[model samples]
Target: MTDFDTDVPPDATPHVCEHCGRPFARERYLALHRGLDHAAALSDDERAAYETAHDAETDDLRRFRLLALAGVVALYFGFLLTYAVVT
Candidate 1:
């Protein structure tokens, strides 16, 4: 394995930034991407593709977070209802 790969933990996969094609050892490289290369980062074609992928990922994350929040709320209510019934 290369030095970059070696630096990354065994459980983590190395990611190349879709925008800049820079190999990042960590997943949190998105924050660096946003800060460093957000404006002049990508070629026109790459920019379009990156935007599409970013939007899809954002939408998926929103959907999953909403689902998780709903599950937590339902579980909380379920417990409250059971407690009320038991008491």
Candidate 2:
């Protein structure tokens, strides 16, 4: 019933890996999977593409972690300030 509990549609995965026919919701995910799972079979161009996608994904994850930490810190300070004013 929650927003996080929403189900994914069957057609959500449009990107199919050529190496394994495995489907992924995003092309980047497919690239990553291919890089990790089919490294032995990958050509030079596919490997390069995977490296680009992996770097982008890593940067995005780092940014998300920093933002989440900031949000948590802000909430903690806000709660402390509220308690100080009320008490």
Candidate 3:
């Protein structure tokens, strides 16, 4: 598997809507759901900004996890190169 394929943490749970207690597959979906269903009227620009920020917030976990995996891969290669030089 690719380094980006990080496993879900045992304690991690699906995103749930606070208003109605409905579960969503991803947190971003909940943000859109809330905006469309529950939030106050927002201007077009405000809505656009909110959606952008929400995407980053909800996707942060996966993004960081992939970065961590990339870090590990780098470390592994660094170790191998160091070993070769030592030998």
Candidate 4:
């Protein structure tokens, strides 16, 4: 239906999930497919562990982003501090 479909290679259309061997149009769709379709099959303990691990990874990423932002701000102000002293 799309105008550029013929222009793109056939292999570029579908994204496959290695875990569930399912095809999706996008990576986010594949992730949603696995999380929704495949997750119900996991045991209660497995689901709990998965949720906990996801939470830990999210927390770690948040901390890393905040720290990086802080470092950038510090560096920017440190440059300004030197510039102010020089001028």
Judging by TM-score against the true structure, name the best candidate.
2
Quote the lDDT for 61 in model 4: 87
Indicate the residue-level lDDT of 19 in model 3. Answer: 67
- Each candidate: what lDDT? 0.66, 0.82, 0.70, 0.66
Tens digits of per-residue lDDT for model 2, 1-87: 112222335757467777666666777777898899999999998899899999999999999999999999999999999999999
Kindly list the per-residue Cα lDDT of model 3 for residues 1-87, writing each as its tens digit.
Answer: 122222335477866666666666666566676777766865575467568857777699789999999999999999999999999
Candidate 4, poorest ten consecutive residues by summed lDDT: 1-10
Per-residue error at 38 for model 3, in Å? Answer: 13
Alpha-carbon error at 5 in model 3, in Å?
Answer: 34
Candidate 3 overall lDDT versus native: 0.70
**Order of all candidates by TM-score, from best down to worst?**
2, 1, 4, 3
Kindly list the per-residue Cα lDDT of model 4 for residues 32-55, writing each as its tens digit: 455567796766755565566566
Better of 2 and 4 by lDDT: 2
Pairs of residues at least 3 apart in sequence or in different chains that clash in candidate 3:
none
Off by over 4 Å in 3: 1-55
TM-score of each: 0.59, 0.80, 0.37, 0.55
Q: Model 4, stretches more than 4 Å misplaced?
A: 1-37
Which residue pairs collide, candidate 1?
Answer: none
Please give me the total number of clashing residue pairs in predicted model 1: 0
lDDT winner between candidates 1 and 2: 2
